[model samples]
Target chain A: EPEVTQTPSHQVTQMGQEVILRCVPISNHLYFYWYRQILGQKVEFLVSFYNNEISEKSEIFDDQFSVERPDGSNFTLKIRSTKLEDSAMYFCASSGGWSYNSPLHFGNGTRLTVT
Target chain B: TQLLEQSPQFLSIQEGENLTVYCNSSSVFSSLQWYRQEPGEGPVLLVTVVTGGEVKKLKRLTFQFGDARKDSSLHITAAQPGDTGLYLCAGASIQGAQKLVFGQGTRLTINP
Candidate 1:
């Protein structure tokens, strides 16, 4: 099966450092999303990207967060300055449908740790 | 804001047992999805329900969408140890290709 693939399965960075998590969504998928799960907490949405523009974002996706699709298959989430609270599992999802009825496929996620 | 509350946060049952996990929300959804997540891994999509009162079956797992589209349930019959995992329910509204709001999750253990 063609699954979403993420790089650096785990990341550890200094509190003030910047980090970029990468993902390669399925080739046929259109809409892409980024979500995070803090330990023992609900998976929270961070942002959504479609047609090369941001479709939606949550409050948690503040100035520190940014997403880009620099190429055909790559999607990335960059955090300007990592915070302790940023330590979580970051997941990337992709879907082929244009509507809510479409199912989203998720990657294994990158575990981020800020020291 | 949308929220999904899952009941029986943790469950431990023996093999061949039956169990039902619930996912509820106050806001109506255009679609709902169920996933099973293993420890230290991302959630794997099991099924997606689009219409109200829709039912989908996968092997021994059955999923039902609420009549109002605000809730859903997952029933497992004759569950095996392979069924042990964190089950999550998520919903999305119709306004846009908005982000999915996930439930806290139901941790189930099926011991053989």
Candidate 2:
């Protein structure tokens, strides 16, 4: 089955360093999103991208966080400065449309560890 | 802000047992979705319920959406070891932005 793919299954970075997580959503999907799950915590929404722009973002997606669709197939989330609290599993998801009925397809996720 | 509260954060049952997990919220939703996640992996979509009081069955698993669209439940009959996973429920507002508000999740362990 066609699925969303994320690169760098696991990453370890120093605090204050910049990190970029990459994702390739389903080819035909139009809406893309980034979500994070802290250890022992609920999955939290970060941002949503569509038409090369961000549609919505949460408080957790502050000044240090940004998303880009640099190419037709690649969507990336960059953190300007990593922190200890930034350690989490980041998941990329996509959907065909914006309707409530559209189901989200998610990638395996990238584990980010900041020390 | 919308929030989904799941009950019985953890459950452990033996093979051939029956169990039910619930998702509740005070805010009405346009749709509700259920997902299952294993250790160190992302969530996999199980089912999506759109209309109120809708019921869908997938083999031994049955899903029901409340008539008010603010709650849902998942019931598993004769659950096996394969049913062990973290189950999460999410809801989307009637405005239809496609943003999901997720519940804390229920960790179930089915021992064979």
Candidate 3:
């Protein structure tokens, strides 16, 4: 079965550096989302994108964070300036629709570590 | 903000034992979903319950959505060691956008 795939399973960057996390969602899926899980914390929604624009975002997704579908298959999340609190497992997900019943398919995730 | 609270943050039981996990919220949801996550992996959807008071069974696992759509539960009968993992519940709000609000998760250990 097709699945979402994320690159750079582990990422380590300096506190002030910029970093980009990449994911390739399921080919046929339309809605895309980004969620992050701090160690031992509940998974938190970062942003959702559809029709090439951001549909929703959480407070955690502040000025430093941005998402883009640079091409047909690649969706990227970039942090302009990384912070220690930004370290977490970032997951990319997609679903066929935006309806309540549309189950999301998630990627294994990219572990981001800021020092 | 919508929140899902899962009971019994951690559970340990021997193989073949039965167990249940509960997810509760004051706010109603349009749908509720259950997921399982192994170490270092993203959550994988196990089941989705849309209608209120609905019940769905997946093999030895059963899921039920509350009549008010504010709660749900997962019951595992004769759980095996393979069933041990982090179980998470997420809900989709009726008014909010498509983003899901997740519970803190329950860590289960089924010792064989």
Worst 10 residues of 1 chain A by lDDT: A97-106
Better of 1 and 2 by TM-score: 2
Residues A20-90, candidate 3, lDDT per residue (tens digit)?
A: 99999999999999999999899999999999999999999999999999999999999999999999999
Best by lDDT: 3
Candidate 2 local lDDT, residue A88: 96
> Each predicted complex: what DockQ?
0.70, 0.77, 0.70
lDDT of 3 by residue, B26-45 (tens): 99998999999998788999
Tens digit per residue, CA lDDT, model 1, B1-112:
8899998899999999999999999999988888899987789889888889999999999999999999999999999999999999988876445478899999999999
Best-first order by DockQ: 2, 1, 3
Clashes per model (N, Cα, C within 3 A):
0, 0, 0
- Please list all clashing residue pairs in model 1, or write none if there are none: none
Candidate 2 vs candidate 3: the lDDT winner is: 3
Residue pairs in collision within model 3: none
Pairs of colliding residues, candidate 2 = none
Interface RMSD of 3: 1.9
Worst 10 residues of 3 chain B by lDDT: B91-100
Model 1: runs farther than 4 Å from truth?
B95-98
